[model samples]
Target: MTKTIIFDFGNVFINLDIEGAIKHTFNSFKIDALSEEMTAFNSFYEQGLISTKEFIEFYVENFPNISKEEIIDIWNFMLKDFPKHRLEFLKQLKATSKYKLILLSNTNELHIDSIKKTIPFYDEFKNYFDAFYLSHEINLRKPNKDIFDFVLTENKLIANECLFIDDNEDNCKTSKFLGIKTWHINPKTEDITNLFKLKSELFN
Candidate 1:
């Protein structure tokens, strides 16, 4: 019946460049691809396993030419905009109290602070969710079974009765494997405001 809705915060809400940050890094380092170690460091940082200072230090150590401020700017370049209509949709959805809404986002401290400055209604948007779980804060991340399980157990939600929405295909696949229904949103073609209209069968 989809009594609970799990929402992803990145592309599903705020727009992201996804590759913009990497492109900036590659330009700064004159490298075409990220090293295996570099990828691991980012993953570790996303999981909140590393401190912000240490994460910044890794880049400082690798690219001595770039200042800390420049690194911070490149890292945060992926975040774009948060559409007001989406926030309105979420607010209306919350007001209805039709479902238990949970915001599950794979985000770090810097990105969040950046959004707060750009998105004036950031805190107001948060009030739309019954529970807000940020990966860095929770020490858990998306596409990880443990994080999904934690949300399920904590909310006393049956996976079959929940719907998860994310812009990442891998995340949706993982949630599906855990018995939760999913919508891998296409930001260009689909708007979350039309969720029920788009997935009418789910309601029926």
Candidate 2:
């Protein structure tokens, strides 16, 4: 039986303008495409291999004209509203105590700080999770075997008894490969409030 439900943060709980953010970043940097080194630097930041100050410095050094605040704004452009209804859904789920709830997100300090500042119920949303694993804090990320292993091992969970829900197909594929069930949700057409209805077979 599935006793655990692991969720992804972006596009799952909070809405994100992913494509718009990418376009904004490119426009701000005046670059046609992200160079390999820049992409590697972002990955390092996400994995907590570099400090936020270091991450900002890299951008400042590369794009000398952009101010610090502008860089921050560009970096945070992807984040959108977290609908209150989702919080209501999570609260109801937590009250049930039917399954262990966990949040596994690939997020960084700046983005989180922004969310906490803007979202009033951020703490409440976090408290509902039995385990909250942020890639920057854990120094691990999704779509990787090691991170999944960490979650399963740390929680003493059986992969087959867990359901991971992520909007990214690659991340879902990785979890499925590890014997866990997954929902590769499409944010445009789906809402997490219908979790039980959409994956009724697993719950039953």
Candidate 3:
């Protein structure tokens, strides 16, 4: 019996354009691909091990030509829009009260700020959730196991009774390893416009 639904914010809720961001960064930096150090820095940033200032400074110092503002823009270009239909679907789900809803997103402050501006109803959507866990706020991230453990312990939820939904396969796999049921959502392949269709068993 699934009593809780854990949702991933990016892609699952709002669209993410990672490729576009990468292309924009490459054009700005005139680089073919990200350096090994940059990749490590990003991982640290995502894990909340490094502050946004530290992350930005590290890149600016390495790439002197790239302005801080430009870096911030490129970094935030990954975020797109939140469709009204998905918001309606979530609102309906919240009304059901059949399962506890939680949002677990691996995102930074800048991204969240950008999202709030783009989606004027961000707070209203957040209010619908039983818990909203942002990686930077919690100082933990997905695929680390610690974060999932924290959610499970904090919510007093049994892994078997929670279904985790994430766009990232690795995150879903980690949750599954912890005995939680998972739906590895592929935004390109699966349209969340009709989430109830995606998991009818829950409603049935």
Candidate 4:
């Protein structure tokens, strides 16, 4: 039986328009694609190695014409609407108290600030989780074995007894490697609200 449930934040709980955001940023910046250096910087920022000020400064320096506020807006373009039903489902799930609910997300401070502003019930939604591990706070990101190991070690959880749900296949792949059961949720066609109904076999 699954004793612990790990949930990914973006695309699992909250929706993200990654493609749209990229397009908007490219259009605004007059660039075809983000440079390798720029991508690396973003990854570093997500890992909490760089501060938000540093993140914005990188963009501002690269795009000399862009202001700090514009850079922030562009960076936050990926976050989209968070449906209420998902939160309700989670609340109900937590009410059961059957499994330890943990939230593991590769998120930055600015993204979280944006989430709070966009999702009115963000605080209530967060209350359902027993452990909330943000990449920025934990200094670890998904798709890396270290992060998974940390989670298991920190919670004193056996890998086989944990179920991780993530929108990204790479993240799920690492979890599976560690012997953790995972559901690589397709946000386009699948809704996390159907967790129990869809994964009934897991519970049994």
lDDT of 1 by residue, 1-204 (tens): 879999999888899888777788788778999999998888888889999999999999999998999989989988998999999999999989889999999989889989999999999999889999999998999888899999999999999899999999889999999989989999889989999899866653
* TM per prediction: 0.97, 0.99, 0.94, 0.97
After superposition, the stretches of candidate 1 with alpha carbons farther than 4 Å from their true spots are none
For lDDT, the strongest prediction is 2
Looking at candidate 2, the ten consecutive residues that score lowest on lDDT are 195-204
Q: How well is each residue in 1-204 modelled by candidate 4, as lDDT tens digits?
A: 899999999999999999999999999999999899999999999999999999998999999999999988998999999999999999999999899999999999999999989889999999999999999998999899999999999999999889999999999999999999999999999999998878877654
Please give the distance, in angstroms, between residue 200's alpha carbon in candidate 2 and its true position after superposition.
0.7
Model 3 lDDT tens row, 82-200: 88788888999899899999999999877887888889999998999999999888888988899999999999999999989998989998999999988888898986666667777
What is the C-alpha local distance difference test score of each model? 0.91, 0.95, 0.88, 0.93
- Prediction RMSDs, each to the true structure: 1.0, 0.6, 1.5, 0.9
> What TM-score does model 4 achieve against the real structure?
0.97
lDDT of 4: 0.93
Judge candidate 2 at residue 34 and give its lDDT. Answer: 93
Cα displacement (angstroms), candidate 1, residue 134, comes to 0.6
* Candidates 2 and 4 compared by TM-score, better number: 2
Arranged by lDDT with the best first, the candidates are 2, 4, 1, 3
- Give one digit per residue, the lDDT tens place, for model 2 in 43-68: 99999999999999999999999999
